[model samples]
Target chain A: GGIITQTPKFLIGQEGQKLTLKCQQNFNHDTMYWYRQDSGKGLRLIYYSITENDLQKGDLSEGYDASREKKSSFSLTVTSAQKNEMAVFLCASSIPQGTGNTLYFGEGSRLIVV
Target chain B: GDSVTQTEGLVTVTEGLPVKLNCTYQTTYLTIAFFWYVQYLNEAPQVLLKSSTDNKRTEHQGFHATLHKSSSSFHLQKSSAQLSDSALYYCALSEPSGSWQLIFGSGTQLTVMP
Candidate 1:
């Protein structure tokens, strides 16, 4: 059994400030993903990495950057925080299976932009 | 483009009564898998059930859902609801050829009362 850990469970940032969320997974999975969760909007994929040093743009990738420097770590950076924005960001890892993969997620990091 | 849709934003049910959460999807890929994920209060979303084969029912934790490819639906159902079942549920679609990315629906929140 392994776990995914997200740093800084709560982040408070000022508008136009740059903020970053970090994720670490010990599952040794081949894939890692970052998703933004908003009330009534569901979960939107921001970025994902199929392997170390690889990145894929998701539907909501604009204004966000991701890094996969190592297989166990993935990081997301918000270029400019939006004013009064509040959202929870989730990190997940998964191993590919037949036609699908079951994801394991971290508790999540909540971001508040003032 | 691939997308999942969960019609209900909120559902309230009495304990011991039947409950259902609707989920539908649209994808260009012929071979895909569907997933139902449950998230309790302040917890990460976890896989509740998954299936790929058309018309085959998948069950877990007393909940069941059958994949109906013809209708492009995979609705979650339970014969008896419990207070413990109150949570946010999300339906997701995974396309094997689409880099195994899981596209999620705009989740449904179920509140089971005593």
Candidate 2:
């Protein structure tokens, strides 16, 4: 039983401000991902790390940056917060087994830009 | 260009009645995997079922889904709806042979009535 922990259950940032969200996983998984969840939009991938120091962009990575400082920790940063950009950010980790890479997700951090 | 579409944004069913959530996908790859994830309130999404083999049914927690490549669908079904099943369900796609990213659908919110 592994767990993914995301810091700051809620965040409020001003327009053009930079904000960071942190995630830590005890699963010792090889892959970590950050996703943004908006109403009626599902969850869109923002960034992912396959290993320490590795980063890959996803479908919605335009204004976000990610860093995998350690195998157990991954972080995401909002470059410049946009007003009314309210969404839930999720962190997940997975261990690839054959073709079934089952993902485990964190509770999520809700961001509200003013 | 691969995407997942969960047709029902919200589904209401009476307790003990059969329930089904439709999920269809568009993928160019031959070998792909599908997943059903359940998210309760204030909790992270968890994998309920996963299937990679075409025409094979995958079951978990009394819920089942079969990957039908011919129809490009993997719909989640349950014989009886329970109040505990009232939650948000997401359909996801994994392309292991390509970007190795998990693409998710908009999600279906299931409400079990007493």
User: Can you give the DockQ of every candidate in the order shown?
Assistant: 0.86, 0.75
Give stretches of model 2 more than 4 Å off: B97-99
| Cα lDDT, model 2, residue A57 | 88
Predicted candidate 1 versus true structure: per-residue lDDT over B17-57, tens digit per residue: 99999999999989998999999999989999999899988
lDDT of 2 by residue, B34-99 (tens): 899999999999999999999999999999999999999999999999999999999999996434
- Cα lDDT tens digits, model 2, A40-72, are 789999999999999998888999999999999
Per-candidate Cα RMSD to the true structure, in Å, reads 0.9, 1.0
Judging by lDDT against the true structure, name the best candidate. 1
Clashing pairs in 2: none
CA lDDT scores, all candidates in order? 0.94, 0.92
Candidate 2's DockQ is: 0.75
Docking class of 2: medium
**Ten-residue region with minimum lDDT total, candidate 1 chain A:** A78-87
Stretches of candidate 1 off by over 4 Å are: none
